[model samples]
Target: MSDAISAASLLMAVVAILYGAWYQEIMHAIKITVPKHDKQINFMVVHNVLVSRCLPLTIMAAIVFLVFLPDVIEILQHALSVLGEMGVKSYRKYDSVRTAFCLVVFVSFIIAMHLCRLTRALMEVRRKLK
Candidate 1:
């Protein structure tokens, strides 16, 4: 399971880097120019910023979390068991890290859906242009 998590995180990091490079190349090829102060901002700037900077940072953080998750969970479980022994009610049956990980995956899926829509729209426009 830890290996799977590490692999997934590494895969995501690689994909993000590849996509960011592809996006930058496409943007450069198109010669897009958007005013920074424009009232209505387009996704190019936001996407570029996120892909170039935030995505790598987020991926690194997730990788770090994955690396330490086992130790954290073990410590947490031990604490909970000790508390339960002292007559304290403990809900150790739930795996919060797994739940959070699932949520992250789900949210990423939703974001990918949106990106797919955007990609489809771009393809349609390109097709019409040709």
Candidate 2:
């Protein structure tokens, strides 16, 4: 199961990188004509750059999570068993670290999608202004 997760995570990371690259390339190809206040355009450009950079970090975090999941799970299982023996019911518990890591990865992916949408919206606004 850990191995499968690792593989899937790696695949996602690769896809994200490719998508980021393509998105940036397309954005660069377009000419901005939006009659926006300087601040808005600057903010938009900064946000685009930040999102692009975050893609790599997101990928790295996913890979790290996958690599550590097995060990983290083993530790959590042992802790749960010990607690269970002590009369503490080991309700369905998972490794907190693994769960948190996965959540971060998922959130990062969502943010990336949102960033893409925002970029598109900005481009559309720019086109309309021309």
Candidate 3:
């Protein structure tokens, strides 16, 4: 019975991983296709900023903060002492917050990259339109 249960669990895990991979691939394909509205977004200043500066800095900061979350929280509390002085509260669930914050970072990066690609597509379409 134990052997059967272990095998079933392993099979379920494999199936879940396969489904996740397939879903990610489908979503990625959908993301790459440009929409009509996306062409209107002025990707001039912000796109350059995200691609050149903000993206790299954000990536590094996310890595550092995730790896040293406790230290990062302590540093932020100390550095932004004024926030505390003003009655702003720090997160008590550091680990939970960190996990959610990491997800936010990941989503932001994905969105930024998509916008960059959309901007490039818009530039191409602009020439054709004119």
Best-matching candidate per lDDT: 2
57, model 1: CA deviation in Å?
Answer: 19
> Taking the tens digit of each residue's C-alpha lDDT, what string does model 3 give over 91-123?
442344434444443443453455445445444
Question: Could you give the C-alpha RMSD of every candidate to the true structure, in order shown?
Answer: 10.6, 9.3, 15.4
Judge candidate 3 at residue 83 and give its lDDT.
53
| Candidate 2 per-residue lDDT over residues 68-101, each given as its tens digit | 4565566667766767776545444545656554
TM-score of each: 0.43, 0.37, 0.30
Clashes of 3: 0
What range of 10 consecutive residues in model 1 has the weakest lDDT sum? 121-130
lDDT of each: 0.50, 0.54, 0.43
What's the C-alpha lDDT at position 61 in model 1? 41
Candidate 1 residue pairs in backbone clash: none
- Arranged by lDDT, best first: 2, 1, 3
Which candidate model has the greater TM-score, 2 or 3?
A: 2
Model 3: CA > 4 A from native: 1-94
